[model samples]
Target: MGRIKPQTLLLQSKKKKGPTRISGTTILTCNLVVGLIVLSLVATYRQWSNRSRSQAEDGLQNLEDTDAVKDLKKFDLPSYAILNTSKGFVFVELHKEASPEIVDKFLDLCQKGYFKGMSFHRVIKNYVIQGGDDIQGLGAAEDWIMKGKPHSELAVSPKHEAFMLGTSKAKGGSKEFDLFITTAPILDLSDKLIVFGRVIKGQDVVQEIEEVDTDEHYRPKSTIGIINITLKQEI
Candidate 1:
């Protein structure tokens, strides 16, 4: 054996060669770190997106609840009644200012489900279609009307016109409710009944209702009724 020189040792080390051996543990740890970083980024982005969408939906719901209060006040718009009937939907603009008592009463009744299944027992063609308290649950006619609180008590009368809603005392003195929609301009009933509102839209529905055949007492041969009445007003 001969002693190797320092220069020989240096040259041999330089020739020694290939890449450093990276262990399996090191490679796996590095890949796991990168995967965790990507997963964190994705979670953060999803949370942010969900929060933004929830905020947008809440904003829209609040807007609907208040319904542009500033605009309603500025325009002095009255509340509306959306009357849903078998024929179709009829929109009535309530005369809240003109007759607050009756208008409120009608709205109260609607809220109470008092007219839920009430029918237009009296459907006189070319004149009017009456409802409010007659005819039971869309299934059969009651042959009797549920009159307004007291037929004996009288209220101030309003002008009569086409599509106007009014109520009259029954011949038995216990009949009539909101009394219902008019299909034509009736001048005679001005003093006889109290008018609270008028149909603003769906006059065609009212016409169709007016044309429904009725029996001798003007009771509709087929039941025609209010499925529901919804009031739209400020929150």
Candidate 2:
């Protein structure tokens, strides 16, 4: 409680000044760091959104440029045929223009040997010999493959008729490789098969498959596997 010496006073001043400068610098550094983090987050979000939008636009553009839609209005249906082993052989005229994305995906899968050695798990005589579905079998013969999404939607046309392979209902058909044939009378199906192509020459093969012994659900008793599918132009 006596008077302060000069040396003590000098030391006290030095301690106070050092701490004040350090505190100011630390506060400024923290503020700068917080601002930089917020800016980085904002940049990342904007980049992600822009990339998604760009991809969607590109997809739409591709559909617009395809030949299927351009020729559909001309009343000329594009054709395709398949040589299947179990079903013998089959031919189909495609609804190419109407469902370009879906049809292209189907055609691509067939060409890439995806349907080789795959069994027609759902073969219905009167309804459809639905195949290209491999979800059930687990044996060594099982070969599971995935096809990309398709873009085909059902449409009500004045020329609507049964037996015509139409596009799938709602937003096209499933991404899987499943296909259905028309066995219904007068083509009064509530849903349309995406008619990428029509059967032109292989109705006999379809008939042979129909003759096979089938379950109550129309699934064949013995496995009728598709050995390979070959596509070609019509004569």
Candidate 3:
């Protein structure tokens, strides 16, 4: 047999090696591409997961806020005061529209039974009738400062007209529980007093309270007790 040509031998050797090299290169390239695809998939999954978690938390927070607002809306604003006094019942309408904070404080106090069985310590005929004292003639039991902060200035201007409620300032310059109702218009006390309500019904009972005998200090001689005070919501 004739020996194979050198070119033929070379060609046969190239064909054998070419297949192995191509297979190895194809495998390496495929591995690289597969690895890149896996990494991209993982990155995309992580990003989507984080965004979903954030959206869930935000939705929960908004739901909680909405429930809180709904709960707050359940109670209507206090509109009137039904005072069961020793003399008779006196009904006063709160000026919640004008002085919301002050009226709210007053209603809160009344609801907590703070004014129950308290005496009308001060009664000045044709002027004012002051009350809401825990101890008779000793002054108010609770301080009358606004709930959150000390308001150095007034929110609403006081009009000390007949049946208008006023906050009597204590000697220490802080308003205490001493509340008063005017029998007639006295505009001079407007700057110092915070008028929160006015008597809408039962002015006769207030007049009777004003007629109660008092001493030189304007404290009542006999106990003019408040049996109870209740807040009523309009509509």
Candidate 4:
């Protein structure tokens, strides 16, 4: 065997180093591929999560739309009512400032005798008597009452759940527009019933109104008549 030259030995060493460099390059390329795949997976998961959340929110909004605040663009104001049953006449003045659009829509129903001969649907012995539900005889003549309007801002009582009476038109069904008077003082009703207008003179007349024998549902055992309605400006 012949002895190898120094240059030949050096050339062999260089060839060995080339293979190691290629191996390192291969490892780096594999790492880069893995990183890109991880990034894509994370992005896809985030997009899916966002879509799921959006769907949940849309479902909640649909439920709310069916109740109140459905068609805000169609809100009106200045609706009023006077219930004159055998018990007596109970005049109700509405608050139109907070929801002027909703108020006007209710007033139109009252002007049409839409609530005539309706029975006091619900009455709480020392608390309240709710009449405006056609199911009890005070509801809409031909149309059905849609869900009540959700209030944007409660000027009367934040905690008060009282609503007034109104009829449902073809465009929209009137849900709630009935008056709820407070037996307590002004401060007591501050956050309960939206006290837009009080009975300035006929309050005693309302106090003297008749109350029928009620069942658990507050339904009057007999019939109650709402004779006539008169409108006047608040002083």
How do all models score by TM-score?
Answer: 0.53, 0.49, 0.58, 0.41
Top lDDT hit: 3
| Candidate 3, 128-234: lDDT as tens digits | 67776433332332222112122233244348457887664432333446677877665555655678788888899999888888777667899896899877776
Each model's C-alpha lDDT? 0.69, 0.58, 0.71, 0.51
Q: How high a TM-score does candidate 3 get?
A: 0.58
Give the runs in model 3 whose Cα sits over 4 Å from its true position: 1-75, 133-158, 169-176
Q: Give Cα distance to truth, residue 193, candidate 2, Å.
A: 3.4
lDDT of 1 by residue, 55-139 (tens): 9999877876684764554236438888889999988877776776666667767788777777887776555677866523222
Q: Ten residues in a row with the worst lDDT in model 4?
A: 141-150
Q: Which candidate is the best by TM-score?
A: 3
Indicate whether candidate 1 or candidate 4 has the larger TM-score: 1
Residue 188 lDDT in model 2?
A: 35
Mark the 10 consecutive residues where model 1 has the least summed lDDT.
Answer: 139-148
Q: Whole-model lDDT for model 3 versus the true structure?
A: 0.71
Q: Considering TM-score, where higher is better, how would the candidates rank from best to worst? A: 3, 1, 2, 4
Output the lDDT of residue 19, model 2: 35
lDDT (10s digit) by residue, model 2, range 1-235: 8999999999898877443345888999999999999999999999999999999999878876777756653334224746576657666666565667766776777778877887766654454455665333211121111121111332444223323443344333456565545432223333334555556666677667767897765568998877886665555
